[model samples]
Target: MDPAAEGTTTISPQLAERAERSDLHTLGIEEEYLLVDAVEPRAVETVDEVIDQVPEQMRASVQHEYLRSQIEVASPPQLELSSLYDSMRVLRTTLADAAGRAGSRLVAVGVGPASGPNSRLVDNPRYHRMRERFGDLSPGQGSCGTHVHVSIPDDETGVQVLNHLRVWLPTLQAATANSPVFGGHETGYASWRSVMWERWPTVGPTPYLQSHEQYLTMIADLQASGAMLDEGMLYWYARLSASYPTVEIRMGDVMPTLDDAMLLAALARGLVATLVQEVHAGAVAPDVPHPLLMAAHWRAAKDGLEGTGIDLATREPRPAWRLLRQLVDYVRPELERHGDAELVTVLIDRLRTRGTGAARQRALLAKGTPVAGVVDWLARTTRGEM
Candidate 1:
């Protein structure tokens, strides 16, 4: 049966109990971007200088990442999708203008073509300690990602949402796979950033937890093991935000356009809302094995939407579009609830036709556009000028 046509199921006891208190679908987005020379498109170490150029009023929204060649911007929590888009656009335009004044450009690609051997760590004691502890994984680490935070009522609901959401995270990764090139070479994966990110000990798909107690215990164990710096370092693809009352999905590469980013945010918020509804309707989370989930993630990272992805329901190879459609169908009710169904449908159609960021980058290279030209295109598209 087509999951999309299915009628609403009964609300579970847990969901029914908290329906009155839940926020439903409030969202916030955070994106990291690479800073590069405006003319040459090479990664540049100027975050400190660029941050100074941002207007005083907007200063708090823009921040430095671990790498000096990278910067991050966050949108204030918003209930309307349009408000989120406007916030992102204003931040991007302001940051781009500031970078321009500093002879740099803010490129939204996953990793800069000029990154690798020369990447510099930001001048901070925390970053210094990370470099000292992680060693090889610390250097040459210049990649960016989009994180979506969807509000939940409390930790118990957040854990259930994470469990239900894990199976679909790979599909999310494939849809947003924007990091095709890294350190000046095509990495043969749509999201080379995922590969680069997995090198960190704490990153990847997390195991299902039975309760909030289990979640906290697991985090405590990881922290005690010295592999993690603290609770804030729990870098699973999705996790309860250490700083917010939301489940943060951190699986997407920084998208090439505002539309792409908003598409991701919409889907993320819809997924959270759908899962919350499922919990209330008394649906049990799927018992997908952790290893199989990891394999699906690897395939999505390897092929993106241009190739096949693992179907979580069957653990078999399926076309990427088919998996995406199933995901949409599964969350259709929630999408409609939040008024995102039309926007998501249109954006998915566009992605299917135009290809993902990796595919787009390859197309440019195939057309005899130099790597620098590719970077310029990404910068222009990021600013919504192209």
Candidate 2:
């Protein structure tokens, strides 16, 4: 039932061999998107209706999100980046078509472009309890984000992967930061979705941990402290997935296009693959100070790729683009091993040349387009029509 299997593209045999070996580390992606009115371009509570319209064969891949106005679609894990990319593209196109049939547009971004209700809570007991516990911090519907999951061999290795993945987060955040406009105007911060998302008690960077046992201990402590209602609400920027044997990185806003999402997916898989090797080689995870790491996260969220960020290595401000390039270099061998170095390089160049999602949204707004028009643009671009 893998959609990517339907339209397989032929490739060089040498790259094909690498891609075959790359299956050891699979890639999975989940994205949350607002269901907005096609004309008014405001959040609409039609996720249920939209999901209902999904093709019967693809129903397993689509579901409701935290908000009633939000829907989520996950591409099945793929052993190869090309397959993962193809499946995701099909999923977006299919889900978007379903939304169109339901009279709403599925917008892929961090949050809605316009203001919405204080809460559009989905009708579920767990969701209700969360609302009771967090109140206004819980959006009835919530901001959108792209969650990338790369398979790890085991839990212990997953913990180590999280550690290695930490230093690269700020760069990833800057690379994918998309939410710039909210309430119909500029929010000043590059990723307003991330800014607003941090209002919740559990969301943000994860603390460096020693082992898988420690990872569980921390979660149990958070649950006992009332910061988390359940394991499902861990909400760390990156964590070991509870439902799957994968390291889930949820730091970035939902990228507006298939190519953008694939960039993150490829890098994530490469990072996980590289880190797993180090794990076996008995390499120590870099222990960055928590406060400094928090500051780095803040800078990336505030400025995105266009702005300078704190270089954790030297403890100095450097262009986010430079950090991103260094990250690519750090994982180049793994990218090559996965047969994705070329594609990843091309995507990185395209992203840099066009600017991050936040920059793109700000650019349109600067031209005096109404927020509604921005919403229209979001819809079109998300549908890959732009």
Residue lDDT tens for model 1, 123-208? 77766777788786844647788888887878999999999998899998998888888777778989988888899899988778
Q: What is the C-alpha RMSD of each candidate to the true structure, in Å?
A: 6.9, 4.8
Model 1 CA deviation exceeding 4 Å by range: 1-23
Q: Report the lDDT of model 2 for residue 359.
A: 90
lDDT, candidates in the order shown = 0.83, 0.82
Q: Give the TM-score of candidate 2.
A: 0.93
The candidate 2 region of ten consecutive residues with least summed lDDT is 1-10
Which runs in model 2 stand beyond 4 Å of their true positions? 1-23
lDDT of 2 at 201: 86
- Residue lDDT tens for model 2, 298-325: 8998999999998888899998898999
**What is the Cα-based TM-score of model 1?**
0.93
